[model samples]
Target: MPALTAPAKRLHAAWLASHAEWGPGLHEDGFGLLPEDDVESPAGFEAWLERLAADSARCTYRWITEGELVLGGIALRHEGNNSVDRAGHIGYGIRPSARGRGLGTWALGQMVEEARRDGMDRVLLVCAVGNFASAATIERQGGVRERCRNSGADKVWRYWISLGQPAEGD
Candidate 1:
């Protein structure tokens, strides 16, 4: 079974493998990776991890792993910062090879529990309008469609999940 684990140095190589699968970009969500994050080098990766640790008060980051292999990442933003406003309270992504296995759905459900434990009444989740898989995952978690807005050339769909209620698949 896949479990959510904190970002650790021991998973550097495994993380790199997963990063490679996404090719090159800062588009990988849920990891909280920033533009300045250098995850390719061991030292740089450590620095990035340290940065994430420093921001733990504002966000929670985790990796979905089955043993030593990294399958994906999930992040829960605790504070209502600009990121939370734009990207929503949660963001996640599964590795390409791990797609279609319900890993995203499972990970998202776990994160919702984490949010509830943190005392949040609800969370906002946004996905590209074209991303049916992500939309489905969020909907399965009892996410209600709020509105759709334009972000550059892409349309973004926003949903809200109330923690007061049980998730659909739970």
Candidate 2:
């Protein structure tokens, strides 16, 4: 909602470009239209970008710390629309190319900060039980796993992050 004030322009552009390639994975929005990259030929991906750029319902954005066009993560606030499935208070992928560098952990921390900023005393995060990477990401962000269960073919792990007290392991 605010203009980029510094070295954030690159991160903004990179973030948009990555989102342009979004596939069938869960998004912050409950409903997903195909990404430009997935819906069209390579030649048409650019056109798809044009369309996505024109829509306001895509995703609310943020300006990360200055001097990094390549961001650590993109964070979304849960409108509770996608909370039942793919969308939650937090949803992130480390740009595929950005994986294994602890960006997910960093992003989760940022989401926690956003949750605190939004005045939520606690937040719920769910991940497929076998999604060990995601589960670890949440744990590193101070989430305490409450339980795990089956969700269709996927096992889901549920956790709670308490903003009312010092973070776990801190």
Candidate 3:
């Protein structure tokens, strides 16, 4: 079974294999990777992990894994940051090969519970307008469509999931 695990150096080799499948760039979303994040070197990867640890007060990151395979990642951004306003409270992505397996939905459900445990009554999730898979995942978690807004060149759909209520279609 796949589970959400904290980012760790022990999974470096598995992470690299997954990253290779993602090709290049920091578009992995939930990994919280930045342009300066040098994950290629052991030292740099350790530093990057430290940075994520330091930012834990503001956000939480987790990898969706089954055994040693790094399947994908998910992140929950706590309130009080401008990013929460613009990017929403949660962001996630599954590896291309891992898509269509319901991992995103399962991970999202777990993250929603985490948000509730953290005292958030609700959470906002946004995805590109045409990302049906992501939209469906959020909807399965009881995400209600709030609006669609233009962000850069893409129109993104914003959704809100209330932690106080049971998920829709449950």
Q: Please list the C-alpha lDDT of all candidates, in the order they appear.
A: 0.92, 0.55, 0.92
- Give the clashing pairs for model 3: none
Q: Candidate 2 on 1-170: residue-level lDDT in tens?
A: 11222223334455455545554454522112354344334435454445544542433334333344333334454445453344455555555555586766765676677667666787777877777888888888888988777767877788888867446664
The digit string of per-residue lDDT tens for model 3 on 5-60 reads 99999999998888989998877878889998899999999999999999999999
Provide TM-scores for the models: 0.94, 0.59, 0.94
Between which residue pairs do clashes occur in model 2? 11-69, 129-155
Measured by C-alpha RMSD in angstroms, how accurate is candidate 3? 2.9
Off by over 4 Å in 3: 165-170
- In model 1, pairs of residues that clash are none
Please provide, for model 1 over 1-170, each residue's C-alpha lDDT reduced to its tens digit, 9 standing for 90 to 100: 99999999999999999989999887789999888888888899999999998989999999999999999999999965568878899999999999999999999999999999788999999999989999999999999999999878878999999998556675
Residue 59's lDDT within candidate 3 is 94
Candidate 1 or 2, higher TM-score? Answer: 1
